[model samples]
Each structure stands twice: as C-alpha cells, then as structure tokens.
Target: MPARYFTLEEANALLPELEPVMAELLARRAKVVRQRHKIAPILDDPHGDMGGAAATEMALDFVRITELVEQVQAFGCLLKDLNTGLLDFLSERDGREVYLCWRYGEPRIEYYHELHTGFTGRQRY
Candidate 1:
C-alpha cells in the first residue's frame, strides 16, 4: 500500500490525537512495570509456600505483562519516530514546499519529495 503523507499543518493537527495515545501507552507501560515489581516479591520469596498452581498463575501473568509491555514499546517507538522523523518545513530539491509525513500505521518517514508529493511519491509497502 502507498503510504499517506501529511502536510505540516495536517501533522501538527494530529499532535493532539497522537499525544494522548502516546501518553496513555507510556502510562500503561509504567503500570506494567509496577505490577511486575509488586508480583516479584511473591515470586521471589524463597520460603513462601506459593504452590505450583499459584506459581504457574504468576508466571502466566508475568508473560502476559511482558507481551503487553512489548506491544506498548513498539507503539512508543512509532510515536517517537513520527515526532523526530522530519523537519517542520522541508524544501524539496525542486524548491517546492514539502513537509515530513507521518500517517497512522506508517513505520517511518520514507520521503519528503515535494509539497505535491501526496501519496504519489510515498514509498509502497
């Protein structure tokens, strides 16, 4: 699929949407860490009689939390890439005004070809 490109104005407008999602993901990641810490004592108590069943449950929960953290970390990386990918007002080689693009779901900035670049110059996946 051809990637969608956002103009500076459009990208700026998207900050409001992106910021909250980024914040929520980061907060959730932190929560996951806190949860792991809380469970660590239970898992590490050498003398505590955590039965096989309880230990198994804790192990499963830890794995689930780790997976969630990885997912959120991926999202955070995407957000950071979008935030830092391109200059605010880039001038194309042809001297036309171009802006960095960061549409939803894009892995990274692939081009800043022209103000008219639109989806045409957008690298296809």
Candidate 2:
C-alpha cells in the first residue's frame, strides 16, 4: 500500500483512538515480558518442557500484541517506542516528508522530524 500522509489536524484527531490502542499494546507487551521471565528459568534447563498453561498465555499475548500493532499501522501511524509510548504520523511539511511525533501523556502532537531523523531530531511543530 502507498504511504498515507496526514495533515496536522488529521493527525491530532487520531490521538483519541491511538491512545487506547497504545495503552493495550503496552499492557500486552508487559505481560509478554513477564511471561517470558517466568518461563526463562524453565527453558534454561534444556530438558524442560514448557508447561501448557504458560505456553498458552504467551501465545495469546503475542496474538493480541500483533492485532494491536496492526490496528496502529492501519491508521497509518508508526508505534516507535512502546516503552516510551512514542507514535509518529507521516506528513508533509514545507514540501518534505516528516514524522509528526507524539508521546503518551503529551497533550497533543507538537513535534516533527525528517523521515530519517527519528526522535532525537524532532523539532516543535
């Protein structure tokens, strides 16, 4: 699919929808991490078989995480850092493509950066 570009207003409008999905994504991610930690020692035994329940929970978490991730991509936004809750919407500014950046807990979209710049290069919008 071709890239979808957003105007500033359009990107702002998506925040409400994006926030909840991100929250779920983060929650599931944490669960996955916790589940992995729980299973790590067992797996280290080399001869240990992953118990059915633990395996099921991890599989479910993975499926849900994948679904949540696809939802974000469906909105044409990138989930950059789950740990930091950073999201980016592709947009054009001054005739150049840039990522309109927003992090969780921020009031709204207030920064942007070049396609190659990533978060550190973000500038106030």
Which candidate gets the maximum TM-score versus the true structure? 2
RMSD of each: 10.4, 1.4
- Give the per-residue lDDT of model 2 (tens digit) for 8-125: 9999999999889989898888888888988878767767785467878789889999999899889999889988789999999999999999998898999999999899999999
True-vs-predicted CA distance for residue 65, candidate 1, Å:
9.8
Q: State the number of backbone clashes in model 1.
A: 0
**Every model's TM-score:** 0.39, 0.91
Q: Number of the top candidate by lDDT?
A: 2
Which stretches of candidate 1 lie above 4 Å from their native place?
Answer: 44-77, 81-125
What TM-score does prediction 1 earn?
0.39
* Model 1, span 3-121: residue lDDT tens: 34444455555555454554544454555556666667766878876545555665665566456435534332222232222222233334444545454344444445345555456
Task: List where candidate 2 sits over 4 angstroms from the true fold.
Answer: none
The whole-model C-alpha lDDT of candidate 1 against the native structure comes to 0.46
lDDT of 2 at 45: 76
